[model samples]
Target chain A: MDEVYLFVTKKILFNLVSRPVAWFDRHIVDGFMNLIARVIERSAYMIKGFQSGRIQQYGYVFVSGTIVLVIIFIYIW
Target chain B: MNILSLFVLIPVLTCIGIVFTKNMKQTRLVSAIGMSIQLILAGLLVYLYLAERQAGNMAEMLFTYDALWFPTLNIHYTVGVDGISVAMIALTGIVVFAGIFASWKMEFLSREFFISLILLATGVFGFFISLDLFTMFLFYEIAVIPMYLLIGIWGSGPKEYSAMKLTLMLMGGSALLMVGLLGIYFYSAPDGGQLTWNLLEISKINIPIEMQRFLFPFTFIGFGILGALFPFHTWSPDGHASAPTAVSMLHAGVLMKLGGYGAFRVAIFLMPEAAQEQAWIFLILTSISVVYGAFGAIWQKDLKYINAYSSVSHCGLVLFAVLMMNQTAFNGAIIQMISHGLMTALFFALIGMIYGRTHTRMINEMGGLMKVMPFLGVVYVIAGLASLGLPGLSGFVAEMTIFFGAYQHTDTFHRILTIMATTSIVVTAVYILRVVGILLLGPIKNDHFLHLDDAKWYERLSTITLVVAIAAIGIAPLWLSDMINVSLAPIVNKISMAGFEFTSLF
Candidate 1:
């Protein structure tokens, strides 16, 4: 029974240390992969939106704003 | 110390006066009187130029004014005039006067428009007069910036977009030009001994061949964008399409010529060897502009677009003439500049009248315009004939001289390109005839066009002035050609000194 107790104690100790390390490895990798997939998906969606003319108004606004900024800079500088 | 500053300062002062004027009529009258005085002064300058030329004394520099503007940078407010500059000044005077008359009916923002117009003329006049690169650039930018406001505030049909595109493209070109100018300035002034932007002083310094090769394209293409060289020419048709009639006349008529003039005076003249080496490339691209712009106009529905593209094509011939790098071609270039100016101005003026009455630019919508406006129809046909290089018109003499000059070059490939450009003359005839046939010959289609009246007295007066000038140049080109040849002699000698032989064919 003492041997059995020793063996159970050793096993619990091993699990306590390795389980956290293993969990960390798995979750960390999965989180990284999920972040990459999210980024790629968002980029693809943005490109699709651009091709479908949904982004034109935004583009014009951005361009006009940029031009205004440039003109202001030129005027000031 | 010279009369040249008055060309710029007078208009600027008048524009300032216009700001204080109470009513539109007063503004118009003041602008007209100011321009008339300028015109007379320009005429006197031309007389001086001719008198100098006649006495076989081309070496004497007349009306030189110099003062230090930026001492640290060696930039001076230097102004001078030679024969070619005097002719260009005269051209500006005629166009400005006629443009003022053309815009006499403007009720909306009339004062503002005249102010910008006069300011633009001032810049152009200043550019032609200034002998210093920095001063010239200042005037160049001033001339170009007002175009955006003029077109945006008082224009039609997508004017804002056109204005923005034109301003951006031209300014982008100027960026390249600025880089080139600074590069030349620094390289030529390596000793750091009073860095100078004077054209004559810079020309005296022999720029390294390698550096010339690198900087040549920057300056040429940069200026070529304004000259409507092939790929950078897209802005022109759209800009001219949306511009007010007077703006279109001045912009396409004289402003575009400034580009060619700049390329000639600065790029080619400064780096003759580089220009010689790159002549083939310019020839190819300009040939394409000539042919493509003509065919492009044939497919256009709007009358303004047609004229716009034709200006592109006609201006291409000017670049092509410059690329030929011969005295005859150079003479042809000057003539083409003058001829195209008159022709395009007449075109815009006529188009404006029709648009004023019908409120549409689409040729398909209006027919039998000649039935209502016989006088306009005659002038329109004459202008069209001149544009297509008909034998009796100014375009014919210009194109023939260019071709003859280009043939003297040993490059068989360039000769073929010149031949291909000649085909555009035929294409121009096709499109011009097609436009006249569809609009003037067919049965009246739109009932709305029936109420259109003949041109008013002022319109007739302006049109007649251009028509007379076109006819005068076409019939007796020697009067202008002699002056152009006198100016081209120095350019040819400079190029020859760079080891490119320019043998006259005529």
Candidate 2:
């Protein structure tokens, strides 16, 4: 009777807890992190293209940002 | 001489002292002593301010001293501290003190490094106490120009490119701010009088609405860029990743708070009508920043990049709460600035220490650090928990007050935005725990990591100073909150007095 109890408690219950916990941590949590990383990295890469180290490109951004602000002011006022 | 000026004077004197030192030891020792005195002065200032408040001093600004510097332009070297500035000064003091110790081992041009670092700190101290716009702008530029030398000389990982990018972006922001300030100056006397460049003087008389509408965007976005608002935040991750440990700590901890403080003090307080009208546009941008930065942090494997992105998210929350324009939210904004400042500094310091030992910042490359370096690992966990807004931590107190204040707007638009902003909390928890599990727990991935030594005495001192501050705020937030809440009354009244007919952009 004691052997049966040990098998049920240690083997069956322990597997139930450890296996699921490990599975959840590995599959759900880690996979989610990986998936999000890929998605954001793609966007970050695209954004990086606009941030070329060229002095001319930076000038364009400054000019364009000023233009956008001016337009907003005109529209709202 | 006003006592406030000493905050800047001591740092300058320390730089002079460092320049005369013969060896690295004397240089750092002098720098440490100077900053320690500065920190003690800050505590004294706080004590005096509170005691004065207790003695029924209801003046808007305490300990003000104004003197003309540029008479032609009506610019003065004015200095004062209300409760808010006092808090910011204290934050700067603690971070700079810890920063001196954190870089005790710097060997390349050690004297020059310490001098530049103290100079940078001097600008920050001056900026906080100044009430005149011209002097504030002067100090603001003084603070920013040192980063190029700091990063390009001593930094790692694409240091040159990162430094150039950071300097140019910040300079661009300053150019816009200059235009906005000059515009405000031109309209300073709408009733046709002499123009002045004092913040309190400008606030006393309302700038005409047409001019306010035109200049508000420039001022807000100028400071907002530094506060890491959305697309403009690109420089932060790269810059922080490349900067040396102490530079990253001071830059993240004390410097970025400059933006939020300026936006609240100069942009919003002086131009309440424009802020009330145009709040929607900035609110959307800040909300995107709040959520997107959290998601961005989750993708980064490098420890510094992870923390830099988290700073974007946290600082974005500061701007968001400021825009809420209520006493409670404003109080929350100030607290968030301090909390984020301390924790992010701790994060950068820990990352530096860990990188120094393991020689790599990639999480996947290191594992089970707890087995070898138990002290740093445990502190890192505590920092992570604080950042994720666990109850009994500074993060929780700040975020809860912000959300509660924001939800007071009974309109559907605010309700929806509030709910959207609230989702970032869960994302923050996910990233924090994932890093903890991967970096501290699980099996040892590198056999070499087993033999690494734990934190040194100096490193322990730096981290523990920050940790104690984090816990102090977390455990007993009420006193700080009440102080901020009292000072916020006038600003909140000014903001609320503006008519609220512009909630919906469409």
Candidate 3:
């Protein structure tokens, strides 16, 4: 009976702590990893498209100008 | 001395002048000149308003001009500017001027287009200035009527359907507004007292809470529909997508703001108790508009449709802020109105430039556009960044204030609603970056686009002006915020005095 009580107490403590940690690992960490992976993949695709000389045909002037404007705006703000 | 009258008269007479001119160049020249003059007057008015504020009398309306139009009904042709009206008037002036310049290249029915555009501007200016409800409604309809012709006649792809949908929906809203106005008139008239539609006079009388409750939704929803509240907002995207560039810019930039301004001025200011009770409903509907609109934009392939959806989402933020019923939130709402107007105008202008060159708007078909027209691409991205509320942009400041103000309210439900609305910022980022990446950053798939040139000088001018205006507001919002706060203080005080408690949850 003494051994069984000790075992039950350990089991309750383990469940209480591990469940929240497990849930956080699954939802927060995993979700962040997924988001980062998606962003990286998208960036890689864009870089690859840039390398193939495809970006040359479209209006890069506008894109570059927009980036500069955004940077300047951010600096000022 | 007659600056307000000249602002309205110049535009009205210009419309008349354009209609009579058989030559397109002559009509264009006249319209441009008229716009230039109006811009100057607007600048003068803003300067005077600032001067007045500096002198420590910010509460009094500037450029007070009154003429009796209907003595029998006690209605007067009253036009004046508080800080809010002046800011809106300045917005209209800038947009109208830029719109004229943007449409300079149009070859189709230029005379008629300029005339209608000028007429629309006249109505907008009138709406902003008019203190009388009857005149305000008349000008509201005037501003709306030209949109039908503008879109239906000069628009592309299902123009008729889009125009009809927009006109019918807006007219339906106006009908409700008319009912609300009539209700106020009849209810306010004493057994021996004369009926009046004068806004200043009517506001003096205490409207019954029950009657206000009944009329608030009618008037609020009536005007809210144009502000692009959910479900009733279906017309905006379709209308904007089909309308010409200048029309799109004006409609999104100024006309939609009229709806929000009217709702605040007429409904909430007059019926404070009703507004307090029913604000949560607006909060819920507008939050849905913000979130759902962002999702809607993600699925759209057309450039105009994307911007149109963004407008719906951004404007939803304004309504959300208003319903928070606090000074900070209300101030944010006004700022959002102005920010969205400038940002969306920039978007439409850039899209118009691209559409002019490519003769197409499909995202799939547009790739690596940044390679050729770098200036246009960069401006497009800047506008996109602002739209998504990237920190330091006008959208970010406005949205942050709104969220902060909303969270202060003790109501957990409202706080949650605000949280839901914030998701739109993320969603907006997704679609904006997706479009930027796919359409502007990727490999140019079409061989035909290799020779595409940058935006023309006129386009450059229009775009740069908008960029400066947006940056000014984003970077140093204090000047504009102070102005808006000054105007909002009385309204906030009234709401508070009506016994609405604002408990700070934070």
Candidate 4:
């Protein structure tokens, strides 16, 4: 009886608490870093193309950057 | 001239003289002389305070100077020093004096710089001596407002943004502190007591528990933010990184101390009942800051950022030790403030001198500094050792006493937190060694730095003063501990007298 109770309790905690904590640490923390990495990469690629007169999406960069910053500030405030 | 008034008045008058000065050399000279005089006066004041304590006059403030100011709000311009206050006054003197010398070569707006610096010193001096809450609050703001111009104008690498963020965060903290102070004034005399701004008198009144609960968080978090309390400590790293050397020395060294001092003198001392009930919230956060800050420093390449994060770690100990609610821990807390102030000042001073020569702060980009600038390298080692809590240093005694007092508690949970805090020491040691090994040892990274000159004469003088002070306190802490414990006794008594077993609150 004791062994069964311990196993069940461990299962509940692992599913309920530990899983969420691990998920949050990865998705939220690493996801933010990954997103930042992606933005910088894309911007570098776009700038290189624009210097060669091949890319023409200047307006999108400012608009998207402003929107992201706005959302962050709103969350912060 | 009252001694307490001299502490404030000298700096004020010197600031005026600085404003009228025509050139940078004259400005630095005048401010340097003024700060030296303040240091002498502060030393004398500490001596007198100690004599009074020895003669059994531990009843109230040692030397209080009173005058009528702002009569409309029932506030009096009062100033005095207990054992702790006198010590802090001396700390301000040392930091400001050393700060002037450290910035001896500053050419950019040097006249304006010295003037603002001295003015800020006056406000800090006034705040430490104030017995009236209203006067204290006024001086606190006076100390804070100068940072905007100082950093925003003279600082480097995104100075304006960092300055604005620091000023806004600190002001928000003050707004919260104002609300708490007002609540205390309103609910002070629930039993037909008279209204007053005198802190000592207010402590005698039995504030209702409900009000204390509401007020304590506001006061703790309010001051805690300035002390670089965790979760709210983000501004400090950027601010310190952007600030000039002398500003970093003062900000990390003495200014952040105002937060810890205010938290203890006003927040915890006035509302012991609330402290008993709510200390756990602080302990958890402080423990996290201790560990988190250490981990944060481990990866930083910039010299100032590492020290800034280290400060967050060390300053967290001040709050953590205080919340232990034991005599030994409180003693350790005060010593930690003094210890950290001197050590961090020395560190920043050396960093400034070294960086001036190398023109780079990246650890990976510099090596064999001990070969070229041996004096700076040696002092950096000493400061880093003191920081990592090496035995026979000030940090060692402070940390040991804190641990001793912490475990004296009845609870096992706090011990677990204490262990976590203790593990941070290992992380601290690892990073300190890593930085030392990388920066001070091995061959020179760039031949450009091989011919670099070591610390100048003024820099040498500053290091000798700070190192001697650090060593003296570490080796012979008995006198300092006695003075601190004498003042701490009354606070512990008031808390114990509340008849609340603080651990039982859990």
**Per-residue alpha-carbon lDDT of model 1 for B1-506, expressed as tens digits?**
36788898789888988999888899988898898889888888888888876777767256787899777888899988776777788888878877888887988988899999999999899998988999999999999999999999998999997898789789988999998888788777655666678887777777888999989998998899899987678779779999999999999888998988888889998889999999889889999888877766766789998898898899999999888888988888878888898889999999998888888889998889999888988899999999888877888888888888877876779778988988888778878998899888789888877778988987897788788878888898887888778677777888899998778854
**Tens digits of lDDT, candidate 3, B1-506:** 56788878999888887878877778878888899899889989889888888988855466777888888776777887788888888888888888887887877999989988989999999999988788889899999999999999999999997898789889989999999988887777655488777776777676888899999999999999999998678788779999999999999999999988988889888888899889888889999888877777776789998899889888888888888888888878888988999899988988988999888999999899999999999999999989888777888888988888888876689878988998888778877998899989979989989988998887888888788888888899888888877777667767777787754211
Considering summed lDDT, which 10 consecutive residues are worst modelled in model 3 chain B?
Answer: B497-506
Backbone clash pairs for candidate 2 read: none
lDDT of 3 at B317: 88
Q: Rate the local accuracy (lDDT) of all candidates.
A: 0.84, 0.87, 0.84, 0.84
lDDT accuracy of residue B66 in candidate 1:
89
Q: Which candidate is the best by lDDT?
A: 2
lDDT tens digits by residue: candidate 2, B171-253: 87899899888998899888888898888788888888888898998998888778887657777887899999999999999
- Winner on lDDT (2 vs 4): 2
> Which TM-score values does chain B get in all models?
0.97, 0.98, 0.97, 0.97
TM-scores of the candidates in the order shown: 0.86, 0.86, 0.85, 0.86
DockQ of each: 0.01, 0.03, 0.01, 0.03
Give the backbone clash total of model 2: 0
Q: Which stretches in model 1 have alpha-carbon errors above 4 Å? A: A1-77, B190-193
Native-to-model Cα distance after best TM-score fit, residue B466 in candidate 3, in Å? 1.0
